[model samples]
Target chain A: MSEFDLIRKHLTGIGARRDDVVVDLGDDCAVLRVPHGRELAVSIDTLVAGVHFLPDCDAESLGWKSLAVGLSDLAATGAEPAWATLALTLPAADEAWLAAFCRGFAELAAAQDVRLVGGDLTRGPLTISVQVHGFVPAGHALRRAGARPGDLVCVSGALGDAGLALRHLQRGEPLDDYLRRRLERPVPRVELGELLRGLASAAIDLSDGLVADLGHILAASGCAAWVELDRLPLADQVAGVVAGQAAGGADWGLPLASGDDYELCFTLPPEHAAELSVLAAAARCPITRIGEVVPGSGLRLLTSDGHPWAGTVAGYDHFHG
Target chain B: MSEFDLIRKHLTGIGARRDDVVVDLGDDCAVLRVPHGRELAVSIDTLVAGVHFLPDCDAESLGWKSLAVGLSDLAATGAEPAWATLALTLPAADEAWLAAFCRGFAELAAAQDVRLVGGDLTRGPLTISVQVHGFVPAGHALRRAGARPGDLVCVSGALGDAGLALRHLQRGEPLDDYLRRRLERPVPRVELGELLRGLASAAIDLSDGLVADLGHILAASGCAAWVELDRLPLADQVAGVVAGQAAGGADWGLPLASGDDYELCFTLPPEHAAELSVLAAAARCPITRIGEVVPGSGLRLLTSDGHPWAGTVAGYDHFHG
Candidate 1:
């Protein structure tokens, strides 16, 4: 089959069907009708083999992760998933590989009710770029520049599991299935993001770990934050590893600096803190209050006993790391 | 510098700025207020080194062609350009190359009044993916499915010049400056596309040559077309190349079957034929009527003697070719 036929076979008649999409595939451009009183949110992300993923990584997981990460950006803005355009480059036309990849991509797209509106398939080194478009009510989108001095810093679900899984995989060590899944398939907090639309003061998705991702919030909001390392939520396996460390000298690098958590790190006013449990229940995800926004300009880490804690914290940089 | 630092240094404070952009760079997602009654037009294109262009292609021209082809998609749909997101992957962070690329990109963006809203920079084989968003009045966008029998098939500007330039470049032969620029920096006919919105019945951009690209409209419209070979508009250099061929046996392969010529091919009804000159004058692009839509299922080429012509015609396919 031609590349065009391969794309149509694997991509069409799978994702969500929406009325707002005036034109889908098979056109020079896809046409979308943005509902009145709604603003559109757009973001694009690209993943390259041997850089973003292992060269021999599973095609199914790669496809899921590609769309999931782009959706995470929409989640950060509290935008409802609407449509996505994919630009896929492959070394060759492998029918079995394309079928498997499309299955994984379609699964998440169906669950999220997002439609695939357009795509370009070309020949090159394996690279996947997904651009997602979402909708948010006028004047109601969450931003990264609204955090204030006295708000609570919160995160959803556990952290560091994905980082730990990557380390073990790199070392060729066996790991628990949960950790493996965490690294292979991350669930973006779309529901929780929408719930925070009017309540959370500021929001960002945790792709580059808490310290680094939250630093973006601080820089944009012109404020500082302090995170109590003891308050970080950890999975049971991760907690056991932390417990084995020497008392009060444990390294928090995995949770603080490792990437690919795909959770939400947001700030909320003290008065709205009462709604945390409701938001968590609605989203079906755990919510943890890990820290608080402060008055200054840099991130401050506090030890369990309330002493200022300092340790090297850095995030992944694709080019200069 | 860090990857984030490199992106900000090269991307910010450039391109068109508009009030509809609620959030731009440094945000998880760029939010835009789509004007009421306008449908969003979205398309994406990916250019890989050695596949779309030479591996050693000039960075500035690469940048121009990268975005121009995507805008050609918008032009095919009669959409007004608005915002763009760029996802760039490179082997390394070269400042000089990045600056030159940005200059070409910014120049076209400013000329088209398109805003640079978001971007991603990463490390990998050199690849550039540009997703452009535009606006078209509801129900007014041109499509490839409205052609009917008796419609006049038309094209904007001359064909085959870019293909000729590519041929010379691949053979390392001397070429005229005009032909060289045509291959390196072919202009997208965005203005002519918007002008054809209501006047044309079916439209498409000529990226994959006239025969193959026009085949798309035939398949979509469920009709056929007949082209008179003698009426084809050719640049002087291309005409000379054809003239030197043996009489009555000259190959039309370059004009009929080559790619990378970003021109428009549309069909107009007899009622609107009078407006062709007006559109050409307004868009400042030469218009030529070369064929007519007919009630058959496949393309029919006519020789100068008005007899059926038979020849081999095939367009570029990334995977199979």
Candidate 2:
């Protein structure tokens, strides 16, 4: 099929239709109107086969994950996503694969009310680049450099599930269906992020593990933090794995350093922390207080007994890792 | 180097800095305040090694072309360029190559006053995906579906130089320096595009050859066109090559069907067409009147004597060509 035919047949008319999208798909440029009194938040992410995902992974899951990754960044900024542009590179035009991929993409895009505006498709080794645009109320964007000392550090949703799932998949070990789902289908914390807008002092989505992502907040905010290791909300399977390991073993690092969590690690003042129950209910997710920001630099891990916990902590580096 | 380190050392602190940028690189998402009374124009284009470009081409040229391709889309819409996000997938982190690439990217970005806002870097076979965001006055953005039957067809700048350059490179033949520069550094008609906003009836950038790109405008506008083939504004080298060939030879196909011209093809009413000299002077580029839009379907070509001229005119399609 010609490039235009391929787009018309498989990739068009499959996403949310928003009135704000003045011009979409068929045009050279998609013209969109950002609402009055709102600022535009934009982010882009790229996923490559065999590096970001297994080369033989299901096309549908890859599609969902590709957009999810970009949405996660917007979520961190408390932006309500409105549009996305996808640049897809493939070895060939596989009709069945394209159909499944579009189905997966449309599902999440529909939920978030984001329109697929414009994109480019080319022939190459499989790679997907998604750029998401969203809107946030003026002066209300959640940033990583706003945290202050004595504030409370919190996280939404359980951590380490996706990373542990990757471990099992790599080993070819049988894993529970929940772990499989966590690995392939991550949910961006969109509602939680919007809820945190005025309340949270600093926020970031956990992609490169808790220790690493939290470190970013601390570095940007110029403050230290102490995470109570036992307070971490690990996935059920991840908790079991931790229990099976010796204290301070390398496995203890799973919840701290394994990447792809897609959870929000945020900080809020002590007064706002008291309203966690109300905020969690509104977000439809559990919000947990796991640590506190301090007047120093770098992140410190503390055990239940309040002693520093020593374990390997490294963020995922696409180039050197 | 770590992924974060690579970005910090090579990709940060370059490009234009605009007052609208509320939060830029190092944030989860870049936040920008779009001026009131404007609409956002976004477009994405991907260049994969060995597909959109030569795998071993100069890194600086590749970087410039990468951003140029996406900016060309914005130019077609008569949008003022604002922000750009680059998703770069590289086989490895070669510092020297990266520095050169960033230099090229920054050159065009600074000239257009476009800021490098947010992006992702990943490990994979070389691929560059650039998503550009620009702004146009609400209701003033140029589109491809507004042409009327009586409008005059026009194009900014010469054609076929880039295509001929590619042909010479592919065959290891000697080519002029001008052709080489045209192939390496295509100037997107940003000024000309904005100048035609209120005057042009329809607009599109020449990427997939004149025949194909113009076909898009015709299909969308539900009109046909008749081109006086001899009136086409061919580049000096392209004209010389045409002179060296027989009548209706493949060389004629070069100027008609070879892609990668990144020039603006537009339509305007006869009254507006009369002001071409003024527009050209303001745009600082040659504006040639090549044809006229007409009722019916598909494009018709005529020689200087009004005889039908038929030659192969297939557009460049990555999947099929």
C-alpha TM-score for every candidate: 0.97, 0.98
**Candidate 1 chain A weakest ten by summed lDDT:** A240-249
What residue runs in model 1 are displaced by over 4 Å at the alpha carbon? A243-248
Where does model 2 exceed 4 Å of error?
A247-250, B247-250
Q: What lDDT does the true structure give each of the candidates?
A: 0.89, 0.90
lDDT of 2 by residue, B13-103 (tens): 6689899999987789999989999999999999999987887889998888888998999999999999999899999988889889989
True contacts kept of each: 0.85, 0.98
**lDDT of candidate 1 over B253-283, digit per residue (tens):** 7777787889999999999999999999999
Q: For candidate 2, what is the recovered fraction of reference interface contacts?
A: 0.98
Q: Write the per-residue lDDT of candidate 1 for residues A29-95, one digit (tens) a residue.
A: 9999999999999999999998888888888988888899989889989999989889999999988
Ignoring the other chain, what TM-score does chain B have in each prediction? 0.97, 0.98
Q: Distance from true position, residue A255, model 2, in Å?
A: 1.4
Residue A311 local lDDT, model 1: 64
Go through the candidates in order and give each one's DockQ.
0.86, 0.92
